[model samples]
Target chain A: MTTVIRELGDEQRELVLNMGPHHPSTHGVLRFVLHTDGEVMRKAVPEIGYLHRGLEKIAESTTYPGYVPYTDRVNYLEAMFANEAFSKAIESLSDIEVPERAQYLRAIAGELNRIASHNITIGCITMDLGAITPFVHLLRERETINDLIEALCGQRVTHHYVRIGGVAYDADDNWLKQVEKFLNHFEAIIEELDNLIVYNEILVKRMADVAVITADDAVGFGLVGPNLRASGVDWDLRRDMPYGIYPKLDFDVPIGAGEKGTVGDCFDRFVVRVRELKQSCRIIRQCINNIPDGDIIGNVSRKIKPPKGEVYSCVEGARGELGVYVVSDGTEKPYRVKWRSGSFSAMSIIEHISEGLMIADLVAVIATLDVIAPETDR
Target chain B: MTSEALIDYVKGLLGDKTKWADPEAGDNFLTVASEDWKNICQTLATDKKCSLTYLRNFTGTDYPEDDEIELTAHTFSYSEKHGLIIKTRISREAAVCDTLSKIWPAAIWYEREIFDLLGVSFNNHPDLRRILMPEDWVGHPLRKDYKQQETYRGIPTTRPA
Candidate 1:
């Protein structure tokens, strides 16, 4: 089976390598077709749809409330954002007002989910860069957040906590106290993890100055979330678009500062997520301190039939802007539902940036971009 | 700027090439003529005042009842901090519409996704291929009247229903 073949024409000599619908570093059932010239890649075209579950088509058949659980599968890593985006779209169309307490609860759950998602993102990137210890440490910290989330909502990964009009369940005072306790302990854990990987010379050398996305290119390509911010673009839907309780809460939006290398490089992307972790902690702290006491759910009917209209709602997911566009024809089920995900836009930019990059560096680009398969394929 | 002002600003720039639709039941959107789809988008991206540089979202919905597929391009201006929805309806049979990928690179994959799912082909698209569905799939899955193939490469798509 191992036979040597003679080389032919130059065009034919360029090897086409398949980088897995199963590759560990490729991250979640995604395949990349790499056109390589020896060790250097000419371009890496992403071949997706392995995880496509016809989710949008399914939305047409399911009722508004029934669709909440399905949105969880859209981006399992940041399921809270998917849930919130869909719920917000429905709520906006139906004119259902959530109680102040539910808004605070939703924000609290969202920020905590953001932290957990970023933990996995940073951990996976470091792990892909050959730093396993940091990934292990971050995973340990993530479990504590998961435990706190479990205390609030039963499930760990897909909380399904953010429902249309409001969150499914309310957090008890004890659970809120545990969240505060976790945040205090997790602040030191972030510092410890930073020491383990962020500033490490080896990881910096691997990521810094690689795949620098210009601010213009970032905006033009529709890159969202940290990936867009990593390119030094000061556009965050949470602040700029302002939804739910975000207008009342105070938190800083972190952008790429080029501490290790040029702005918008892989290093900047990594650093931005780390900075965002601190901001998420701050937002969660405020939500806990200023949370109002009231009804957890809104005055939504058991059977929600929104008026005939089309609305677009977005939330800042861990990856980027997770938006849900819904067209309701005065029915319980949506007429049309389209998801605009951060990873979907992030995936589109790869073929543009992967040119002339070392084959090994592609992993870093994929990691920093944080393009999850479920989000992209959904 | 507010959404109303932004719509008016865009209308003033485009002149007679587009029509502003004030749907009695739903939200308002700028509907561009089929021939002027690409021209209007190019202007929106390049015009100094209407710098909708970012193509936030592009989607195609099949409206079989109307015998047309509505393509909506949601554009946002990073500099101006405003956004407007541009929509155009093309005949479902023809399904050919101007591509926005040349103006906004983000639309490249989005157009492909629409083409693959809803069967709306974008003219002059760089690489128009099946994105979410298989290349040899029988029909556009998102179409309201789409029929599921009995089998894909000998693998049954549905349990004996």
Candidate 2:
């Protein structure tokens, strides 16, 4: 093979490079305009909106009930959270009461979605860092969770399972049994994943102490979920705000202690998600064991016309605190709907923090942050 | 501090700057003049009694009847565990307000988004450009009166039926 090369002059100038919009590691058509001095990155400006479908604009035109499926497009990775956030916004606006059984189902489905999301986060991060085996292993576990979710909700990616008042359907005993079996098996697989990737020497070196974000910075940037907890913020909407059935379920909110690296580093972020995976399993097990029997749906009006008011409903999604702000003008269609996505703010901090890191480490930073482009652009 | 106390604190801090306070809206909702938007945001974010360090959401809603666009900001204090919503109304003709990007870095993107979608401009924003739309795209799509262009660069803008 013939190679074409250009000789560098004595003058040193920064090289500006475009990373994605099509690159696999960019994760959903996200582009990074990187300024690099050789291997070191001087600045990384993330150019998003490639996936912007005007979801907020769509929400305004669609009726309250008609918008549930559209919410899935906001963050397909954790569609249940978006569904719950939108539905909860409607329920709050219309004064509808969700049944207890439905609340339990929401918790169960939400936790399972969290696990599935974390699987992709962990697997993709590992794969991006050059390890292929762990990605396959993680995907194998993810497929099992997807099967369980598909059985419960009847769809895989955009499971429009949650409704305005409650879930689409109640979990049968068979589905609950499958979830219980999956949780038991998932516990062992998580340990296997940890052994395979977390403690691996190369992965640790690549992630640990790279792209460190302080607790102050995390709070200022509005980081949430594992990213915020990894920085030692000790805040989780499920625990702090106590929405849905989160209060009834007992599970530990994992915070990064920096056991293997500096606190708030990329490694800590990765570890936080792994710990959350285990915690999610614990919550799912508890939800299955103590699930109460009742109506799946609530006494919500089928017309779905909320009075003239506004409401903001938030859920601790797989990525972070996903909030849906809905404004109703005494009409079937919402006046305006704003999706306050955690990934949007998380992605904003990249420019500030990417100044000193190497070009390769930026990938680790991006992966650890788990910035899903659709959610950010939405 | 409880949400009520936070509301009282903000009401006392801003005093006459606050146009109205809606206690029924929940989350300490208050509407203030566009001129005092930045000052109120700074106070809410930095004040110890109301350390609303988190800028949860920033968006603009078009109210055609009022001939103004209402800019709403939701802030949360992790330490206090309380939240507040502040609204500022700007005339639709000159929809400009001081940016809170300085107070909360997260507002940078939010401001750009509001600017891109609602045609509201945020003065003093470090980088004010269309975020979710193409640079060449015309009109703010989220505006109530916006009319979708038939074509862009001679390409059909709508799906062919």
Best by TM-score: 1
For model 2 chain A, the run of ten residues with the poorest summed lDDT? A1-10
lDDT tens digits, residues A104-217, model 2? 999999999998999999999999999988889888888998898898878999999999888897788998998888888889998887777789999999998899999989
How well is each residue in A1-378 modelled by candidate 1, as lDDT tens digits? 112233557746677788988898988998888888788988899999999999999998999999999999998888888999999998888889999999999899999899999999999999999989888888888899888888888999888898888988988899999999999999988787777778999999999999999998999899998999999999898899898899998889999988888999999999999999999999999999999888998988899999887988889989888988899999889999999999999999999999999999999999999989988999
**Cα lDDT for residue A18, candidate 1:** 83
lDDT against true structure, model 2: 0.88
- In TM-score terms, candidate 1 sits at 0.97
True contacts kept of each: 0.67, 0.62
Candidate with maximal lDDT:
1
User: What docking class should model 1 receive?
Assistant: medium
